[model samples]
Target: MKPVSILFVCMGNICRSPLAEGIFTHITETAQQQHRFHVDSAGTGGWHAGNPPDPRSMEIAARHGIDISGQRARQVNTDDFERFDLILCMDEDNLARLSQSCPPDLQHKLHLFSQYAHGTTQSVPDPYYGGADGFLTVYNMLFTGCKSMLEKMGADDVAS
Candidate 1:
């Protein structure tokens, strides 16, 4: 089977989305299923393009043994819709923004990342301004969500 390509998106790509990317990447690698996936992250806006994930995001990820420091911000574009099997937005607003530009044929690929995140809220709250503790909270949520997303991909047998 072809590898699944997944894109994580948020408003700025500094905190939530990148953290999701890192958590998902860590999950796949930990399960030795990384070869079955292609992971990347971007934002709805380009204001933080080319910038690394927020420092607090980095700190929180490092605490969990996942490093997001290497992720640079970028804006979501039409190419993403075509390239990813799943283009998951961190929140409804970003999902709506992506919906406007995503090609009609590929619109089915867009989803709220938290949809796979059972027990968590329907959206992954952005933690950019909430403070350091917020990063920790967001991290746990994304960790659970990413694990669920992996299971949803039929990798449940190996997702533990």
Candidate 2:
């Protein structure tokens, strides 16, 4: 089967999206299903372009044995709408931003990352302003979402 390409998006590539990307990548690798997909992350805005993920993000991932410090921030672009099989946003605002910029016909590929979370939150709250505890909370949330996403995206990809 051809690998599915997935892009994780957020207001800034510094926090939630990168965490999701790292978590998803780690989950796939641990499952020995890394060959089944291509994963990346981007921001709706380019303010942090060319920069690495937030220090908090790197710290939290380090605690979990996932290395995400190498990933750099980039803004979502028109080409991404066509390149990725799926574009998942970290929250409602991120989804809205992607929806507006995404081409009309290809808008179907856009989605909320939290949909796979199965939690009380319909969105992954940004932890950029918080401390270590906030990062931990977001980490747990992404972990659950990423794990469920892998199971849902079997050989056939996303289900209806």
Candidate 3:
């Protein structure tokens, strides 16, 4: 089967989304299912384009043994709607923005990242203006979402 493609999105791509991409990538790699997925991230806006993730985000990921420093910020584009099998946004704003811009036929591919999370949160909060602790909280949430997502997709059982 062709690899499943996923794109994680947030407001600036410097906080939540990049971490999501990194955490998800790390999880898939650990499960030995890297070949079955293609992962990336983008922002809804271009303000931080070409910048690396926020230092707080990178620091938190490093604590978790995941390196997200190499990921650069980029804005979501029309092509992203076509390129990814799933486009998961961080919060309601992102969901609405993507929904408005997404082609009707492709709308099904857009979703909130928290939808796969077993917890009650319906969205992932942005941690750009928050403290280092916020980044850690977001990381844990993304890890849960990514892990549940892989299992829901039936790709979590690959031999490590």
Which of 2 and 3 is ahead in TM-score?
3
lDDT of 2 at 105: 98
lDDT ranking, best first? 3, 2, 1
Span of ten consecutive residues with least summed lDDT in model 2: 151-160
Of 1 and 3, which scores higher on lDDT? 3
For residues 120-157, write the lDDT of model 1, one tens digit per residue.
44888888879887898888888888888788777745
Candidate 2 regions exceeding 4 Å error are 116-121, 155-160
Best by lDDT: 3
lDDT of 3 at 104: 100
Query: How many backbone clashes are present in model 3?
Result: 0
What shift in Å separates residue 158 of candidate 1 from its native position after superposition? 4.7
Q: Which stretches of candidate 3 lie above 4 Å from their native place? A: 119-121, 156-160
Listed in order, each prediction's TM-score against the native is: 0.94, 0.93, 0.94
Evaluated at residue 126, the lDDT of candidate 3 is 88
In angstroms, how far off is 144's CA in candidate 1?
0.5
lDDT of 2: 0.87
